[model samples]
Target: MRLAAYGLALIAGLAVTGAPNPAPQVTLDRAEAAPGEQVQVRLTGWPTGTVVIELCGSGGPARCARDTSAQIHVPGGGAGGAPLTVSVPPGGCPCQLRVSTLDTRFSVDVPLLVSGAAPPDSGTVRQAATGPPVVVGASVERDRGWPARFGAPARRTVVLRLRNEQAAPAAVALSFRVGRAPSPTGFVAPPAVPDLAPGEERVIRIPVTLPALALGSYEIHGEIVTAGTAHLVVVTTDHHPWGLAGLLALAALTLLPTRRPRRSIGRR
Candidate 1:
């Protein structure tokens, strides 16, 4: 009788543990792309049991790996978004993207267009030059942290102040460069107007954010472009962490400026 009871208990435990749970399904919601332009692909409605996901072309045999496969996790009934930056391969063609769940065999297809270059945004901001001696503020590293105030999980707003000491109103363009990659061209923040009346001063404050920012020393600088002169100035001083992972992330940011470093004479 004791042997039979132990056998029955073992059978019950195995039956309960062997049940299959529904896996999280991954679907490619939509592709917002520009021909010859790198775009972010977003996914939605993911279920559980998906350890890995991959993208394959329906028309072509090319495949794009998940930027950070484990970065975004989905168990059952969870949703997530992944930012994929891929240069649309040459030519005008329709690319079908199939997103698959490695374990559950769940997937979806998204159609994307590889078209011409993206249109430029003609937004401009100007700042005037002023002063006998324009005194620039110096940046000192804080004792608390490398980027104590500017580190990761930061607020979206970046506040900066510019002083123009000249008597004539100057149209200055506010520009930013992280490492060596220049900020997106054609997107200029409105400038701070400084009083150019010799002793008069002006303060300009601008706020902006970079998508998917990584760890590094991010320098916010400005260039005052006039008829025949250009003044480049570094404004803020904030140092983020520089670990192995940060080095890798900065490597990615550096590549962003490669294709659009300067306008191509051939494209124009």
Candidate 2:
């Protein structure tokens, strides 16, 4: 009887104190996906704010290859949380999708399997005939249409031009790389393009962000069907003179003494 009374008291105390809730959890709509397929992700118990999501490979020397990883921002709040969509690129592999707060104080990793057979080529060649039916072009542009500055984020665009040389529509796989790294975002799995008619040319654009902190020489390479590769070189340097000066000024102000000013006594 005494033990039972103690148990009741403990339960009452817990109810009054309100136990802390469990950490955030993540769930996927499906366990596996094919190349170029989209997967739905759901997050629960996430705090109210912005969260970062990253998809990274699981094995091999290139386990966390930039091309295999993509970053996304999620606005999380409430019990329902938020829903996100991620694309699976070609080549089967065990991958992990991680979601976390900006500071990374709280996070969760969910395993995902990406598997699928490659699409067969139709054998339709382009009339331009230089080579493959697909051509890739890439360029880097800074945000706000400004030139690529040293300490500012830049936008990279990979454009794929498809030409239907055969009488019927043709299907092909496209991939891109930046400075020996796979395009950080899955550029291989873009939206399905409508069949192109004979002599039809279609252009598709894939964009990725290069953070402001990045510096040094980098190259962007785009390929179609392992042929018709295009390359672009980008050189970034530290060019934020104004920012550095401002930081120095702020530091100097902080070090100044905070004593109250002395009053003038001549008038009195």
Candidate 3:
């Protein structure tokens, strides 16, 4: 019953955003490999003046290689493309190849399983604990036209509403970075407001001065972080009636007695 509530809450969150759904983009076309041999990884993408490609081994944070390149120059306003190579290690453990846009400073993660490893069996992986629950959504005024004043820019008010749904109060902090294509070079102050009460929300209005040169696609991400707290969202899986019935049957068996305990061997 508790798990079902979490699912419903997650669904409701989507409705509140009202923002266009955006999907992560990957430029890597394919990974080719031979038995016990090295494989070549090729990636292609956009807004490309310069970029970096990193290779991580066995799903761990350990980086095997960090290759910086300026040769990925897009031609005739074409999409970005680049090719890099990584030697397959002795074992068949899967590896992760990450690509980062140098100028725009965005990153994408891709997983590459080693050649000839057995396919994984069908199963479900569930998070053991739900992390700190932080609600996030963005707002933009569509009808408001861009102001044309030429001096110091006006402070754009960005209000982040944070609600602590846990039983106890939480200390919340907000950290954000400007999206690519007009990224904020310098840091912003008071990354977040702290000490939010349970079942309570605080709207943090950050006054930001847009650079005169700022333009185009911008994105802001906010997260609430605390020590020893789960920082990722937890989602509940669906429960079927058959599964519930099975549990109920098992519970009944615990109460039933076999052969009535020999009728207690009563006298008379």
Candidate 4:
């Protein structure tokens, strides 16, 4: 009789506090990618309803543009899962890919690395003429249309033009910086140009990777040091729309004429 009473009490407690629900989850094939790269994603444990997927900037609003989001319907009471292919978009930045169900309050957030790409060239070499004994040439190569906006990683190439004026061969060291920080990994280092003949000029191409950064203005600086000569080059990334809007507001404020101090006509 005591065992029966205890079992009845346990059942009543369970009925009052329902069972725990499994949380929704999402997984990506990779964690990092350059802009325009394709990534495979798998989702499971969602509630029985339509699900919304979004790729939003880190700390930004929840809903992204249609180009960066997708909607999938899970039928048969959400018993099955769904597989999705997401393409990284241009103007890359650190972001999160979120998945949420319509009926229940179940959601999942996945961190994604959206690396940056170089901007197009303006048909002229961008460099400092007064630095060291090297000339710098930087260009971004991107294909047209979908590839340009949603395909492979854009290629960034930096060409260094060097002329050895000294009689003996010189050992040159090269370093690169992005924004105010050092270059991130996965970038191909500049090749060493040792034993450069006297009065010989050689052009070396260095491949650079522009990782995703916060939406702002960034400067990429490259330096070549050899035989007391230091060649430096600085390139600026194109300002994002938000950054440009801030600049425009600042400029408008500066242009606004300040009210002249009211003249003391009564005193005069």
Clashes (backbone N, CA, C under 3 Å), per candidate, total 18, 0, 2, 3
Query: After best superposition, candidate 4 residue 189: deviation in angstroms?
Result: 47
Q: After the best TM-score superposition of candidate 4, give how far the Cα of residue 249 lies from its true spot, in angstroms.
A: 76
Over 153-266, each residue of candidate 2 has an lDDT whose tens digit, in order, gives 556655556666765434332344444243332222233333355677888776655556455444554444311222232322122334545667899999999999899789
Q: What do the candidate models score in CA lDDT, each in turn?
A: 0.42, 0.50, 0.44, 0.53
The total of clashing pairs for model 1 equals 18
TM-score of each model, paired residue for residue: 0.28, 0.37, 0.31, 0.34
Regarding TM-score, does 1 or 4 come out ahead? 4
Off by over 4 Å in 3: 1-131, 140-148, 179-185, 228-268
In terms of TM-score, how similar is model 3 to the real structure? Answer: 0.31
Model 1 quality (TM-score):
0.28
Candidate 1's residue-wise lDDT over 180-216, tens digit each? 3344222224333322444444444454333233444
Candidate 3 per-residue lDDT, tens place, 1-268, comes to 9999999998898888776533335545556443344444454434433334545554222222322211243333424445555534222246656655433245666776546653332333211112344666444322132342322232344565667777664644333433343343333333324455667766666544444444434444333444234243211111123434556789999889877555567688
Best prediction by lDDT? 4
- Give the C-alpha lDDT of model 2: 0.50
Question: Which of 1 and 2 is ahead in TM-score?
Answer: 2
